[model samples]
Target: MGELAPTVAFLTGAPTQGRIGVGWRTLRGLLGRPAETPTLTVAEVDTHLGDVATTSGSGSAARRSELLSHLLARATSAEQDFLLRLLTGELRQGALEGVMIEAIATATGVPGDLVRRAVMLSGGLAETAAAAASGGREALLAFRLELGRPVRPMLASPAESLDQAVEGIAEPIVEYKLDGARIQVHRDGDEVHVYTRTLREVTRQVAELADLVRGLPCASVVLDGETLALTDDGRPRPFQETMSRFGSTREEQVKALLLRPYFFDCLHLDGTDLLDASLRERREALHRVAGEHVIPGEVAPSDPAALLESSLDAGHEGVMVKDPDTPYAAGRRGRAWLKVKPSHTLDLVVLAAEWGHGRRTGYLSNLHLGARDPDGGEPIMVGKTFKGLTDELLEWQTRRFPELQRGSDDWTVHLRPELVVEIELDGVQTSTRYPGGVALRFARVLRYRPDKEAADADTIDAVTAMLRG
Candidate 1:
């Protein structure tokens, strides 16, 4: 049990791919060795009942404290850490939730696809299937689960360009790439609760939202939506500012953020599980119950060029090309839905570098890039990105970046501005952090450009022009 601490530490401190592999490997070892276990099914774990022993609020504080103290005393430090990680859902050590489903399937002698489907439709965990397989159908079906919790809908890795998605999907619905937090709204009777993807209850955190949702015309409902902090002119506020409000301790400050909810889909309404329905049906349901507060919209067309033009004109992320007839596939990175975003590349100078973690721990990984000021002749930081680096590229950076290093640390190697890289960015936003009072959004490395000098990089004027035009 004590040996599991390193794995827990690995998961909690650095949930990178490498660390997750280590954690899963550790779990695999544990699963291989039999021991006394709880009778709860994998569904129970998915429903987050595994941690109820610690989080249950029935006992007095002192009594609960004593129980916790005794429990901690019997366990090794490693076991304690592992338990904490499991309870908190911070088991980040790089193993994806999908891999865990595979492991559970293997352990239970159930087909991985069956287990995956059950988990997806039920919005439970791999452990639920494991329990069902181990404990039988009765054990798995005992737990009551509700709909509307936005299960991790299948996602695609970012495409090369908006045109790629257009070419792939026949029809696309371009929606706003809102700078906001994703929320799953569940309404039972008049009571409404908002839960993050991790199942954290944020009901109290957004009281006004709860109030607004109470007015939604439905006896029972589950909806997927984004909550954005809006500016006076009706544009989204900064992402960091939105996150700050999310993490704010003051209730008043949170309410002051002026979160506006935008419903994207209707997952459940009037006791129906719409997960099996088509996107068109879901959209129809959304429009029916959403009312005035919910932004009314739908899929535009099957043509890529038309979709792209409409999305850009509407000031949205390029477009999300979804399969109209496909069933909702959750917690899987399937091709049922695709996103298209306009590619805006800039030749930017590397302003600073940060140390990598997990797999690339020994290398300088994340690079902060900047564009030359239009008037001041100084470099203004636009964005920071670590994506798009291959392992070979990482090794090359580790070896070459140090040659220009101004300072060194275990994690990062700071270097003077010398390298020029062509970067792809999603869009621009007004920011207080950058010297130019603006920043780039969703910036990614395209490639290092030896042909372009720092002097030849895109200037702030060009960036501003892109934003304007």
Candidate 2:
């Protein structure tokens, strides 16, 4: 979901990504306890949540800052730590979304599926929880696919090869997997709204796209698709070029990077919802409504290899092989859709590591990967992954990294950037999360490179080049 929630910024102007507007040393001074600490109750903290949690508060910036100072001044050491982690979105007590859904079901005596489905449609866990508490199952069941409101798009799981992707499916619906931005566009007559895969509305930023969708033949429709900037030859431009338009309102930039939509699935059309419909039925509706805008593919191809080859030749990332009989499962990675691509590998340096929990307790599990700076500066971090490590590898790292440790914090162990490991990734994409302005996509550890030095690692330019691959 890194593509969805790229960064977390708080209403207090504090951030876990981008620049640090407030100095940490200045804030740390507030965490220090007074000679005699005063009692700060949970009731006092609850009263401040509404004022500071929203950006539209009527209070002045200085007034809000003063409130925060008083709150932190009376907080116990543990309470201060909890507040910092909660605000920064670093609080992890093992209560995942699924766990909370199950808890709500248990408390309200509503079926878990009903609560989950309501959450998927409403896009708010807090709202669903309130509904379940007030009216039980009836309130949850009342939620439906609303026009102009975007639902969570279904995701594709990765496959090693085309053969593996189509192994058991009888008649697969395979389409070109473009390396572009995923958009879920909803049209209600002349008012068309477009949303990112994360369900954020960007219709204003992509006004031209709105115009195109508004012109579609249907009255009310929901289309799931990919949109990317294309060259004059109709070949896909670099992914960065496509992603740039989503974050900006600059007229010239929007004009320069025009995105073309290629829809693959239709979830709703006219007056009917297709949430429980099979792909065979939905695909037919998609062709009837989208016409030329429907993504090109075949059902039960004689040579899927050639289909994948054609996708690559046309400057796309790969192909998505999907099951034709399965219903759309929103917000989850069902077994129906799978992505296949050529294997990509890179030798990256380990910049830092995070301590693991659960079965991986007492060891560093997630790795912070980086690429070499060609100009002889510090290494630029690309991404992190603990995907392909074995238990033995975890033990080795836990024992070995302490020797190369440079510093430590509550979350991550900083290293000297001397160790290099080979990584296998799906590809690289333009990202604002790292210093290099790029991040590795779907990366996993391959093996440690004992013979390689930090100088032998791949450069940032080479990593960015994979955006085209």
Candidate 3:
């Protein structure tokens, strides 16, 4: 598996193919083949994993992948495959979280509910397990929300219809769903930080957003919301424009496209933690502090269709119907909140494309759609589709996508997640192969959304939400 890229590079006219353009190719050539003699031990392999985990500040991108690749080349083919999967975080062993929690309970003699709660609160199963096993029940109970640390954002399931969502929750608070990037603003005194949904610190990129948070009327606060770039007319710009600013490393470029934050839920305020607070409480706090910055929402809408219409007319994505009394359930797609949209379309990143067949030959036909990871990692592959392509699109993609190529094989060309495409899909289903555990069903390309970035793509939670509805 480590050789996949180096081999493709050689076949596809890569520069300095003999060296893999890094160190790994030479290391592999030196190792020759898996030896009959067992010189390397399991401990030696484990040591490499630990070393890679700790080593940092090494220069250049290719050097880093090659650094790990060189360590991996010493293993046998099967071991190399396992190591590759582990490195990519795609090692699916079919281990259930529920089962792991039960094992933690059995091993620690702590209550299962306590262990589960600690895992949810801490957002680290391994750490939770270690603490439970060593310190017992008290340690698990003591887990609390930290001030600067980001808690997993609560997720919502999709609603088949507004009526279905309203029916599920008697009275729903509907808020317009802005098409933008999720931002978690944390402020302590004058210190302000901004994070993406994946928990990546982007404070430096969105400095204007941090300044806005610093002006909030609270000593310390943690606000969960969305930020989007707006045009001169005060309308939200294309998602691509928003991401260009959000992901920009250059200060001047980011300054050119300032992001405006709309606070929705307040997780913490005035040195008091509100993570356990209900949506009603959070909304009240948000309104009290944010004032004009609070997202425009309607209470107990008499006409659901009318509300959805108003949201769409305002150029928003859709309406989110949330139960007021439900507590903030971090890291969970609970039934407490439901989202209703006009159509089942998602902004997905193009991970790769397969060569077309027959009349479509020489064109990039099939597309691999990926959703954003909440924990700030690589986009996870959900599924592939070749439907809904015009001849113009096929020709354009054939000529265009190779410019963004990362790696390639005979049948497929892997790409960096630079291009975002709008996709219409039936829904999602459970899948063992995809890291998201759900795959798009009947997915078809709508068009390439040049205005959106990979960071603006819909999340894996959004895909999984379709499974419930």
Alpha-carbon lDDT, every model: 0.60, 0.76, 0.72
| Order of candidate numbers by lDDT, starting with the best | 2, 3, 1
Ranking by TM-score: 3, 2, 1
| lDDT tens per residue, model 2, 124-226 | 5666776788789999989999998888668776565689789999999889998788899998878789998767788988988898888888898999999
Where does candidate 1 stray beyond 4 Å? Answer: 1-96, 121-130, 135-157, 168-171, 249-251, 292-297, 300-310, 313-315, 344-469
User: Cα deviation in Å at residue 228, candidate 2?
Assistant: 0.5
Cα-lDDT of candidate 3: 0.72
Off by over 4 Å in 3: 1-32, 35-47, 53-77, 92-116, 346-352, 357-363, 368-422, 426-442, 446-469
Model 1 lDDT per residue over 181-221, tens place: 67778888888888664445678778778877788878888
Worst 10 residues of 1 by lDDT: 13-22
Per-model TM-score versus the true fold:
0.58, 0.69, 0.73
Highest lDDT against the true fold, candidate: 2
Give residue 154's error in model 3 in angstroms: 0.8
Q: Which ten residues in a row have the lowest lDDT in candidate 2?
A: 3-12
Q: Give the per-residue lDDT of model 3 (tens digit) for 7-77.
A: 22222222111112223233333343543434555445545544544455646444556556666556676
